[model samples]
Target: MTTTTPTPPAPTPPAPAPPRRGRALDSASSFLRRRPRLRLGLLLSAPMLWLGLAYLGALAALFATAFWHTDSFTGQVVREWTLENFRTLFTDEVYRTITLRTIGIAALVTLIDAVLAFPMAFVMAKFCSPRAQRILVIAVMTPLWASYLVKAYSWRVMLSGNGVIDWLLAPFGLDSPGYGLLATVLTLSYLWLPYMILPIYAGLERLPASLLDAAGDLGARPWRAFRSVVLPLTFPAIVAGSIFTFSLSLGDYISVRIVGGANQMLGNVVYDNIGAANNLPFAATVATVPVVIMLGYLAAVRRTGALDNL
Candidate 1:
């Protein structure tokens, strides 16, 4: 009894008071909770600023430059707004030929990639185990680690006369196209195939196994199940991949220079006008062709649900 009286209940432990900083934090959180729209606006402000200032601003400047004329005698930007650039772009035979060539190659590359990627993506998504799928993905992305120029230069060497293509195909009496439009298509298809494969693979991966089972249970054959269920779901992914491949191929000038031989695409024309001819206005005008084409392509694809899928 004497010992119990001496303890004095340890001074009641100060009632375990809450931290002041924690109270401030709680008040801040409550403030944000009370103003949800303000919170969302604050969150979005940075990215909106970036998009408006950097991306849209650059595009506006580029299109503005397209309207300005270059002084031929002075070799300077005139800053005079005129439609003469568009007139020349549309009226010139060389520009038309190059535009068509660029479009053709881009289309061919996209088609080739789609054909090659489908079976591979289907096998990876539908057939492979999880670990194997991961390994395959790493393998697919591995080549992208190499410098684009390095790969282009490697292809340049391989496609040269008496290079690897020649050495390998000598026994079969076949030959590589050897530095031309065909060579450009081949290199581009190889480079961009992984881009196509990944999207379609993701789309296929998202397909439900139960859906396939249900289709089979309903008396649908493999082909029928694929046609009725799988293809429709995955078509968006194909279009998504095509958008990337097609747009990238449209503006590419380096690969064209390396493997395109004497052939010039729209990109080469733009590059020449800018660097060789010192014509920024005309270059901007030429540049608008691909931009317009891509815009038109996007408009066409918007109805396919692909944009929403992506």
Candidate 2:
């Protein structure tokens, strides 16, 4: 009797209920579901718009034009499709020489830019005060605001057979100094210097000073600390700067045309093909090589998550 009374007295309590969805979340979910068509359309259209308007349409038109034959006698493209245009590029040793020279120059310029940019970037990051840093940044980026054509032309004058440089250095036994590859590379370097410095500098600036301090605390000297800690941390920046230098140098026809002496690059070839040879399609094809190569590198960067900050 006592146990039965106690059991009956143990009153039951109401259970808590689960929370309902908020109006905002519910509305969002509903909107997402109802707007599937719009979302899908956006997804599908973005790439088409980019490719159709930016690249494929122009490329198709250019390729179509390449089919037209270039008349060697008239130095004009005849309105007929022919393989002769493509064959001429491959057969002629002049085009081959030009292509190779362009590649070599681009490589050399990239190497020089990398080596030159790194030290400057490091100095700016590790030594300079914030005010000094700002001034230096402005100095590095100042050239970009100037006319690229004017700069190249100025370089041409500077590097001419007898230019102002020779005049300035006559007492020191130096000549117009812009005489050859040295002048071309120097001018190209000057032109694209900012592209290299900015990224590398940004990368170095991002490096944690604590890492360097920690390396030093562990008995590592400054150089060893930089090699082990700073270098790895800034690798992505170096690679990015290298890419900019390489790609820009590779496509620079103006610099080469103005001051390269006999050293022609891919850009000049493309220019020559467009006007002198009248072979737009082959030039487009040649142009596509750099695009594809750079895109592939970008893809690799994305895959590695190295471009996350950029």
Best by lDDT: 1
- After superposition, the stretches of candidate 1 with alpha carbons farther than 4 Å from their true spots are 1-33, 214-225
lDDT of 2 at 178: 61
lDDT of 1 by residue, 10-44 (tens): 56666366687799877788899999999999999
Candidate 1 structure, TM-score to reference: 0.86
Best-fitting candidate, measured by TM-score? 1
Write model 2 residue lDDT over 1-310, tens digit each, in one string: 5575556566776536424756677666678778999768777798889987778887767766666655668766577767665676667898777666666776788788878888998899889999999999998888888998899899888767678777788889877766466777888887777788888899889988888889999999988987889888887887777677777877888887788777677787788878877766677656655666677777877654456534
lDDT of 2 at 230: 85
CA lDDT scores, all candidates in order: 0.90, 0.76
TM-score per prediction, in order, is 0.86, 0.74
User: In candidate 2, what residue range of length 10 has the lowest lDDT sum?
Assistant: 14-23
**Clashing residue pairs in candidate 1 (N, C-alpha, C atoms within 3 angstroms):** none
> Model 1 has how many clashing residue pairs?
0
Candidate 1 yields a Cα-based lDDT of 0.90
